[model samples]
Target: MNTPLPDVANSELSQALLPLDWVGMQGIDIPLILDEPGVDASVHARADLYVNLPMPQIKGIHMSRLYTLLDRFAEHQAVSPASLVALLELMVDSHADCHSSQSRLRLAFELLCKRPALVTEGLSGWKSYPVVIEAQWCEGRLSLDATVDVTYSSTCPCSAALSRQLLEQAFIAHFGAGPVDSNHVANWIRQNGSHATPHSQRSVARVRVHIDQDAEHLGLLNLIDLIEGALGTPVQTAVKRADEQAFARLNGENLMYVEDAARKVQQALATRFHASDVSVTHLESLHPHDAAASSSRRGTLPFQAFDKALRA
Candidate 1:
């Protein structure tokens, strides 16, 4: 006769009887199929899946159930708010024996998109965007949020002013006396235009939007375009000489600091997402440390302020 395997998790709890908050796994490798526009449908993501432990007497929750449920759900449907709601519901149902009340999930992945050069019509390349999707099912309500990282160029206004002053001083010193030849001045400027170019550096903008649960689409591409357009200096790919020159002109025109970038993205995104958050960090070429700034919606961010706090 074959003896049934032992189930130690069902044994009476000898340890503390207090209920635990969250019990599950983190950094589980998973494949995600997204249906977002302008982006490919397949991606690899890292996920943190969890469910609340509401029963004090239970030794441990069913860990394998969570993994298998997630695997089955991901293998069938595309990742989205509605699908996530269904998945969390399944997770909670599967943990009913342990008296679980809620479920939460965090998925991190990179979104790839093809972008065209600034000036060259035929030249284009792919860009990778790091993103995170968080969802929670509690009290019969589903809440979701999407966060994206956008890269751009930032030129210090102070540094640009200083550079201009130096260039002006150089021009005056080059022609101390009057009656400077126009051709000589033009040639001189062409030769030394970059003698005092403003200090510029690549920067990243992290923006999170509290998604409407009923919405079908995430609108990530639109969000990216809005922020990138507002900043006016999104990093480029597949650049030719003309494209590079156009990018240079754009940088010269759109001078900003970390605070400026944060506010710009905040305002631009506000038109679409009322409950959102924005933060930007400029890796300064002149300083040893990075400069960063943050901004939020008009009143308060809905997700991090209320829903996230309650979850904590």
Candidate 2:
């Protein structure tokens, strides 16, 4: 005869009879397929699964059950707002013994996208975007959100103006108001263009948008395109001389401050998402500190949650 395994969780009771808001596992590795354009493979995600512990009498929930349920669901389903809500419901149902009425889940992954060179035809490379999806289910109501991190090049407007002034002074000092040949001036400019260079730094923008619970597909690529378009200076990969020149031109044309970048992203997101939260940071090449700005729409993103998501 075989001996039955001990059931400590079912038998034991909580020492303190108080309900907890959330209880479960964090950073569980899993595979998820996304039903979105430009994504052909499954992405690896670090997931945080939780269910509200309503019963003070219960010692703990079935943690193993949560893992297995997520594993099974991920193996078969593509991640989307409806799919996430369904998974949250399944999580709560699986922990019925713990009297769980609400569930929350977070999936963090890097989305790899192939990007073409700025000006080089037939030259493209892959760029990885940090992404996180948070979902919640309470009774019958559902909430879903998606956050993406975009990296770009930011040339400071102030720095550009100062650089121009310095170049102007250099030109006046060199020429001394004498009549100059056009060809000679052109060659001189080509040789001495670096008299001053505007300060530029690689910057990042983190944006969060509320996803409709009933939506079928996550518009991640479209959202990224909007942000890149607004910024106009997304960091490049695999470049030729022409591509580098084109990139420099774009940087010169799209000079911005952190506030300008934040507003650009806000305007881009407004065209699609009803509510958005945007945060932009410019790692200043001039100053020891980074410049940052935030744009919010009615506090759509909770501070605690946004902080945690960013860390992930």
Candidate 3:
């Protein structure tokens, strides 16, 4: 028996132009093997992907091609800026060959690390940290960006002061009223500490940067380290007695609010890399809403340049 294929072009009508800014698979879970310095093995990660397409297309793109490219990247690629640029180039080339015109790629994943505890001697199992890589190419030119999300604890300065005052009043009530010195008051409070607790604010810092295609790039780990150092008190994972003590000292020494966290990150990036076009967003725990700040390096190209090139 012979099977006859139906003719789909019978309707003589043109396909409607769909202006899709972005079109691709998302929430795609895949096990990735990552390679980093100080570690000579594979680490697992899951990626969410996206790509852009042009209008007047016969149908949607072949999503499997994006996954296949990502699979290859996971098996045999580094996550550094340069590696990301190359990966984006590969995505664009592959997509163009498949879908025609230009293509874009976005991969967001969490990079897990076995961080040591603040005062503990042993290491924790694992902590997932967020990372995002994005790239686009058109007319043979490519652009790339990378981002990371870090969490840390922030002690409200105003709340800390109020707690101290309430404790001091209680102390005066117990011991006959007299002017108390700061040191003596502190010592007395430590000796007889009670229910009063300082307010804790959970904060998240997100840093995104445009990659300079020509320079030797630092990997995501480096960016993570920089952000942690800037914040001065990242939440701990694995812990021992010593680690706990160190963490306490760190919190006591570096109490801050969401604003402080954002400023610190901004200053750190500006001074270290002259990162003129980077953006920082700090999610505040003290209030219901979030606070965000953006800083750009002088003379860096704007996002519109990429947009224009892509359209051309």
Candidate 4:
């Protein structure tokens, strides 16, 4: 006996009244080829994508079309800001084709970086950083936002000072002379009297920016550099002896609290990117809570003025 196949419908139902926004998808994982400075060809990343559509007289959008576009992008394209803009434009155009007026896309993923070890030579490991890219097209205009999460080390100044005082007392008890020369005292204090074992605070810096049309050309590498340079010391991936020494020196020179980290990042963005809007969040390891700071330029004001406002 032959079995009969069930009939499937290719069309969707139409409604008289539609909701404000209709289409949305979440937890979509797609492998993308990403381009960054110093990296030729492409690097792999998993992207989570979501898109929204406006309904004029329909109840829903063509969700499969969005997925198909993403599939094409993942298969044979480099993911960049310009490419992202193009993708958003495509989404909006496709939405229009589906009889919609506006469209939006949100993409999130973990970007991987291969960094040399801090202590060991010729050794490397992978470090994954979180990134989010969002785009929206409405009223014939397009806007974009990008975010990155970076980790670093922060040391509390108050803790460092107290630890040093304890070490100084211990030195006085042991050495008996209590550092004869001022230079000797200073050196002894640094070596033994203070911070014999310095407190280590692991912190994360999350930065989000509204990318201007001109700044959209800036590569992810540049953004990463800005963030890491602002933080002073990024956590190491692979570590050799020499790299460990370098990182140690960096940590010793760049001790900071959560407030200091936020201020540093704010200043760096003001000087380098001159971003119109930026936000920084620091997740502190010393405490159970997190601290967040944000700075934005107002009404076409200069970045210096915005910095002053933010600081104030």
For lDDT, candidate 1 versus 4, the one ahead is 1
Off by over 4 Å in 3: 1-14, 18-22, 39-60, 95-99, 120-125, 172-187, 215-218, 274-299, 302-312
Query: After TM-score superposition, what is the CA distance of residue 260 in candidate 3 from its true location, in Å?
Result: 1.1
Q: Point to the candidate with the largest TM-score.
A: 2
**RMSD per prediction, one decimal?**
2.6, 1.9, 5.3, 5.9
Task: Write down the TM-score for model 2.
Answer: 0.95
Clashing pairs in 1: none
Query: Candidates ranked by lDDT, best first?
Result: 2, 1, 4, 3
Model 2 accuracy (lDDT, Cα): 0.88
Q: Per-residue lDDT tens digits of candidate 4, residues 1-312?
A: 589654231244455555556365666777777756554334444444444544444546667777888888878777666777677677766766455656666666677778767657679887777776666666656566666778888766776777777787787775686346777767866676444565776677766655654454536667777889878799988776788778978887887866687778877777655454555555655568776665554333122233422332
Sort order, TM-score high to low? 2, 1, 4, 3
Model 3 earns a TM-score of 0.74
lDDT, candidate 4, at 217: 55
Clashing pairs in 2: none
lDDT (Cα, tens digit) per residue for candidate 2, span 188-213: 89999899999999999999988877
Candidate 1 residue-wise lDDT, 19-120, digit = tens: 888899989899989868778778899989999998888999888999998899779989877889999999899998988989999888998899999999
CA lDDT, every model vs. true structure:
0.87, 0.88, 0.64, 0.65
Q: List candidate 4 stretches off by more than 4 Å.
A: 1-18, 40-53, 117-123, 175-196, 214-218, 276-312
Best-performing candidate as measured by lDDT: 2
Q: Per-residue CA lDDT of candidate 3, range 166-238, in tens?
A: 8777887867676668898778778777536566665677676666655464456777788899889888876
